[model samples]
Target: MERRRSFPDVLAGVVFILIGGAFVAGSLGYELGTPLRMGPGAFPLLVGAVVAALGLAIVVKGLVAGEVIAFGPIPWRAVGVIVLALVFFGFTVRGLGFVPASLVTALLTTVASKRVRPLMAVAVAAGLTLAATLIFVVGLQLRLPLWGPWLGF
Candidate 1:
């Protein structure tokens, strides 16, 4: 018996490795400061090494897994909807404010899935919006307004 390749996993691993390599390469120009005072390259260098290691591990797993895997059909419609929702959120985040932007985007993305209920989407959107606002704005003090200038926040 012959083993077929797991194309998706293998491709993903390669992509990760490429991205990690790019990150490391870009960080090489900057000075790497000590842990007490991190330089421009320090964080990126650390993250890049970790990501590269993870990609290597993924590649190893994919190779060892016999390269034989069954893949489900890609959901193009769902993918399109999610991408559009992300674009919408990006455009509206400043104008509509974080909560509203998040809610609208969540609903827009949720509509892509046939199994999701309207009420459930609303509930999830609300919960996610609140959590995002609290975590990023209130707790982290990210300076992004819960409501933006358009809303007089």
Candidate 2:
């Protein structure tokens, strides 16, 4: 006898498949380039293929094993915290810069976890924000606003 598939697993598989297909289709318009040099489409194509494969595997496992996926109660507080943080990031990043925005986002996310201390969360958020700023701005040399014109960073 086959095991029942979980509803969550099935739903996840379907969602992944849909997302993967969208990615694949979206990447098709991008230039893939010659074998010597990878173009814009290369990474997206690879990601899309991997996502589709994972989705297919999940779906196949669900169907063949007959596993029954279940979900517990929704964590609304956590979701709200994350959404709020992201919204703040979207609004503040241009004005405040990456480090500050990241710090805020991290703090909010940590608090959302509901297990971390406030001080520790603040410290972690600061450290993560600094590190990320260094990596993305300094190391990668990607153009990002460090601060508004007033600060002149």
Candidate 3:
């Protein structure tokens, strides 16, 4: 029996390696000071090395004993919706404030799946919004207003 290779793992590992390599190379341009007084390049250099090593390990694992996963067709609609949702959140967060912006963003993301019902999406969105508000505003004490100037608050 022929050994099977995991295509997704190999591809992901390659991507990680490329990204890590880029960071390592970019860091070389800056001054990497000693461990005691690290320069800007030091952190990136260390991080990049770790990333590249991890990527290499992933690639090796993929080639040696990889799990077989069915690569399905790309859901372009879901992808587009998610991208739009992220953009919407970034664009409206300041204007609409945290709660409303998060709610809308979460709703858009939840509805990205075609099988999700409207009521379910709304509920999920509300939950996500509340969680985000509590985590970011209440817990973290982020200075963003719950209601922005647009709401006359």
lDDT of model 2, residue 16? 92
lDDT per residue (tens digit) for residues 1-153 in model 1: 444456767777888899998999999999999889999999999899889888888787776664566777999889999999999999989887888898889888888997999899888888888888888888998866677777766
User: Which is better, 1 or 3, measured by lDDT?
Assistant: 3
lDDT of 2: 0.84
TM-score of each: 0.52, 0.53, 0.62
In candidate 1, stretches whose alpha carbon ends up further than 4 angstroms from where it belongs are 1-4, 33-43, 46-50, 53-67, 97-107, 114-153
What's model 1's lDDT at 135? 89
* Native-referenced Cα lDDT, model 1: 0.84
State the lDDT of candidate 2 residue by residue for 1-153, as single tens digits: 757666776778889989998999999899998779988998898899899889988887877674654588888989999999999999888888877788889989998876898889989998898898889999999687877453566
What residue pairs are clashing in model 3? none
lDDT against the true structure, per candidate, is 0.84, 0.84, 0.90
Once all C-alphas are superposed, what RMSD does model 3 give against the true structure?
A: 4.5
